[model samples]
Target: MSDPVQLATARELAAAGSVRDTLLVGQRGGYAVRFKIGAGERTLVTKSGSPRLFTGIDAAARVLGGLGIARYRVDSSGLAEEDLPRRRRPDRAVALKRTHENAAYLEFLQQRAEAGRRDTVRYTDEQVNERMRTLRTGRRA
Candidate 1:
């Protein structure tokens, strides 16, 4: 097989009708586009020389459509639908729960502080300590 073609070159070839037939092949990560140019098949690759991958069939179709190539064959026999990677964020869920809990606790503490500020009564440190001792002992200080 000949070397893979970059997206720009592929687009030009597709627009010029040099790409006789297009095939969408399902790969490990995503769908790859293979073009039948002359008698050889060429895979679409990125500028970095890696096989270009599309997240889904629709995406690949849209790209091919933009290149003026419509009507392509899909070979999904290699695709393992269940094996596709899924987005998961268990850490994010735990972090969000902790964030909400912290916010609620902060609000509760703020309300208590505000109530204390609104009260006319005040006590010195020694008086407060004595009051705490009396409360602990269940006796007058």
Candidate 2:
């Protein structure tokens, strides 16, 4: 099993504030622990971690003792067939749970995805060198 995410104490995350949202990315592999403060209402998407990421974070915390920020824990003991039970959080079983809990975060992710998509353009091999040249050396390939 992959590593789990390092969970922080309520106090550790209280500073992020009720309105402020943040991503609890695992230091080693960037797996997300939870949606945290803001994870709802995304208009678009750029990059997203796999659904299994939560499971990995749980695995990670079990392997490593919170890595330095503070004390941490991820509950991994469930008798269900799936180590992680989705029914437990039926309301949030959807890949993206649109709610007050994750509003700001979803907006951030959508914006980044939209912006990145617009900024990047695909080109074929014949146009590759030309595009690279235009991007790097003015307007000539």
Candidate 3:
């Protein structure tokens, strides 16, 4: 394995028609591109030196098309769909339900408040205070 080729360098080689025998190899969860430049086969790598991975074949094809690579062989022998990592979010559904429930309760409270404001009968602060005094002493205040 020669030194991995950076994406920019791969693009340059691809544009210049120096890249050959391009292959799209499928991994457990993604696809990677490998191609021959001169006599050495190189894998495309990111700036951090990790093989650049595309989560889907469509994305990989779009990128390859942008790099002027019109043709490539696909090998899906390594792609085990069942072996791909599954992301579990059991709490997410509960949290979303709680959020919606809370929103509905708040809307109910707001509607009740608006209905209270629209009532024909209203009480002033003094009347409310006198009513409280009468209720406390069992007599008119």
Task: State in Å the error of residue 134, model 2.
Answer: 85
Better of 1 and 3 by TM-score: 1
lDDT of 2 by residue, 21-112 (tens): 33334323234343343544111111342322443554445423332323343333432234433436665656455565489888899999
Q: Please give the lDDT score at residue 82 for candidate 2.
A: 44
- Model 3 has how many clashing residue pairs? 0
Per-residue alpha-carbon lDDT of candidate 3 for residues 75-96, written as tens digits (9 for 90 to 100): 9899988745566898998999
Could you arrange the candidates by lDDT from highest to lowest?
Answer: 1, 3, 2
Summarize candidate 1's per-residue lDDT along 35-118 as a digit string, tens digits: 999989999998889998887888899999989987899998888887455668999999999999999999999999999999
Q: Which stretches of candidate 2 lie over 4 Å from their true place?
A: 1-32, 38-46, 52-68, 79-141
Collision pairs in model 3:
none
- Measured against the true structure, the TM-scores of the candidates, in listed sequence, are 0.60, 0.19, 0.59
Using lDDT as the measure, name the better of candidate 1 and candidate 2.
1
Model 1 segments more than 4 A misplaced? 87-141
Q: Score candidate 3 by lDDT.
A: 0.86
Candidate 2 local distance difference test against the native: 0.42
The 10 consecutive residues of candidate 3 with the worst lDDT sum are 79-88
Ranking by TM-score: 1, 3, 2
- Candidate 1: global Cα-lDDT? 0.89
Q: Which one wins by TM-score: 2 or 3? A: 3
- Which candidate gets the maximum TM-score versus the true structure? 1
Question: What TM-score would candidate 1 get against the native?
Answer: 0.60
